[model samples]
Target: MKDEAFDPVRKLVAPGTTVIWRNTGSADHVVDSVQFHDTADQWQFRTQTLRSGDSVVYAFDQEGIYEYYCGLQGEEMCGVILVGDVSLSNSLPCE
Candidate 1:
């Protein structure tokens, strides 16, 4: 995480991959998934307050798009993780 933004705003990973996010900026950050659409699973992931130098990790077990933003920041500071071969059609519009 960086000031008012998420570095590598988009990431592509295989299902079963473990992703890590490290806070390399000065501000505190909280990474959390957004429920962009209705799903039976209603899956969500979040990190504890991430101070500078802190890091968080998540495992991607399903094949789909995961959109997230900084709770301390806002949607403007957002990112997406594309698992498997998911289409951008299911993703939020790019800024």
Candidate 2:
């Protein structure tokens, strides 16, 4: 991920896929999970403050719409992960 934005603001993957995010910027960045929406797929996850060249890996094991943002940048630098076929009503909104 870059300082201003994630390379791809959205992603579609299988349930077992492992996502690896790298900090390729000149500053720090982090990925933090958004609040849950009362769904079975909601799980807490976050990465430590990532310095330049640092990376984080997360494995999504359920089918759900997972929303997250850069902890350092908040909503201004956010993204969504769509695991399998998820119901729109089952996830928190992200943009």
Candidate 3:
């Protein structure tokens, strides 16, 4: 992760794979699932503020699109994770 954005901005992973977000910037950051907007109490993925060198890991158990953003940076620092079949290579197009 950079100071203002995630390195790839988009990622594709197989179901049950573990995803890790490492904070490589000088500031603090947070990872919040976008699908939990209305049901604030039911968020499946949320991370505590992570300073430089800190990291968070999450395992994607279902096949679907997961959207997330840095709670501190809002839209300026966001990314998408697509959990699907592992047979498809990383170069495969999204959608």
Candidate 4:
């Protein structure tokens, strides 16, 4: 998803796969980690601020549900990542 407020924020993909986060929004946004508070740590893990039209690719090596949000000066837009299995797990019911 490009916009931070993009609906249906959760997406499922296979494990060891590469996913792209495109900054189609008009403002600056960050695909930050929910764990570490340091921006450098985010950058170290390939999660960082993405300007308008820019994008970042992250490879979900592990299998689990990942929660993330926009680390910017705007609304608190959050999203979830379901890795490894395309089918809905108990944590995230199917729509």
TM-score leader: 1
Candidate 3 minimal-lDDT segment of 10 residues: 86-95
Best by lDDT: 1
Model 3 lDDT per residue over 19-78, tens place: 999999898899887742332213367899989999989988888777778888886687
* Cα error, candidate 4, residue 22 (Å): 0.3
Model 4: clashing residue pairs?
none
Instruction: List the candidate 4 regions with Cα displacement exceeding 4 Å.
Output: 1-4, 35-46, 73-75, 86-95
Give the C-alpha lDDT of model 2: 0.78
* lDDT tens readout by residue for model 1, 1-95: 87778878878899999999999999999998885645312457888999999998999999987888888888778888888876554544335
* lDDT: the better of candidates 2 and 3: 2
- Per-residue lDDT tens digits of candidate 4, residues 9-78? 6777788989788877787777655532221112234356788888888888877666566767432576
TM-score of 3: 0.78
Q: TM-score for each prediction?
A: 0.86, 0.82, 0.78, 0.67
Q: On a 0 to 1 TM-score scale, where does candidate 2 land against the true structure?
A: 0.82
Off by over 4 Å in 2: 36-41, 87-95
Q: Every model's Cα RMSD, please?
A: 2.4, 2.8, 6.2, 6.3
- Clashing residue pairs, candidate 1? none
